[model samples]
Target: MVVSLKEAKLYLRIDSDEEDTLITSFILTAEEICEEILRFPLSEFEEVPKLVKQALLYCIANMYEKREGSYYYMKNEGGGMAETIGIMKIILGNLRKESW
Candidate 1:
């Protein structure tokens, strides 16, 4: 995993382990979304950029805080950050490798 559970928890300021599983899922989801946005799997990169990691934390935080509502990743139904699509278009897009 590019971002560890501990790291994600720290970013979310999560003090309890009760939601570890959920957080883990979020990490995985965020990783995949980020990869898609960058058009590259994280494993292919020799070194993951700090911005991409930070964006992962942003994604996790968004999901954890807004778990009550219906989450729309790409659509601006709720309205928030422009990169809400995955918190990747801006952050991860800059790092996009276009490996095709």
Candidate 2:
């Protein structure tokens, strides 16, 4: 099943138990991976764009961090920033690929 981001966004708002779990897992796992990346001691040595990408992914995957239209905080558990971001982007990329 190819799910567009728009479709995923719609699914995100549904309150079904199964959909809730799936959405939570998607966001949480991405956040975890981003957290992992940010924790790395060598992260500074990498490209700034890569770091930004990680940060962005972390931000996007975290729906709860956002409140009233702005991101507020991370869930406080998971991988560092980099890992979370990387994982999110990877997931998003994969999801995009699935549409093709």
Candidate 3:
């Protein structure tokens, strides 16, 4: 749980407790996606890097905002979300552990 429920709520602009469970789930999903992208378990790190944390925030926020969509439409619609994901991917790539 790199992103706490409080942080997720704050990012989501959710001020009530009614959707806490849902928000928590989104946070977990985001963390899993981030870990997958990084090719390493986030728990292994003593402290999550700031860039990683930002990436997680973006991922969670994107998921929360677009839960209704079956897939992320990454074409021509301002491209903000797609660009965010692209930035996250680059951050994850730089942070990923290399195995020999």
Candidate 4:
């Protein structure tokens, strides 16, 4: 996994192993989502960029934080999930490949 359990824990501000399993699940889910969005497997890249890793962290944190909720929204920004999606787009934009 590109985002280590330790990293995920730190990002999630988790200090105990109580939720290790749950955090690992979130990390896996985030990685899958990122790979789907990028249209490529993360394992295919030997040297993933820092931004890509950060994006994964953000995704994992978001998922972990919102697990209890039936629905999610960013009320402060008035953009809901668009802000997150936009950030992901910007992070992956340069790495996107065009098919002719």
Q: How many backbone clashes does candidate 3 have?
A: 0
Which 10 consecutive positions of candidate 1 have the poorest summed lDDT? 74-83
TM-score of each: 0.81, 0.28, 0.80, 0.80
Go through the candidates in order and give the clash count of each.
Answer: 0, 18, 0, 0
Positional deviation of 52 in candidate 3, in angstroms? 1.0
Better of 2 and 3 by lDDT: 3
Where model 1 places Cα greater than 4 Å from the true spot, the runs are 70-83
Candidate 2 C-alpha lDDT tens digits along 1-100: 1223343445345434554545545545544444353443223434434443444434544543332332333345445444545565664452232221
Q: What lDDT tens digits, residue by residue, belong to model 3 across residues 13-89?
A: 88999988888898888788777778788988898888888888888887776666643454434335566567778
What TM-score does candidate 3 reach? 0.80
Model 4 misplacement above 4 A: 70-83
How far is 55's C-alpha from truth in model 4 (Å)?
0.3
lDDT for every model? 0.78, 0.43, 0.78, 0.77
Off by over 4 Å in 2: 1-18, 40-100
lDDT of 4 by residue, 1-100 (tens): 8999998898888899999999889888878777767878888898988988998988787777666644444443333345655777788888765621
Residue range with the least summed lDDT across 10 consecutive positions in model 2? 91-100
Q: Supply the TM-score for candidate 4.
A: 0.80
Between candidates 2 and 4, the lDDT winner: 4
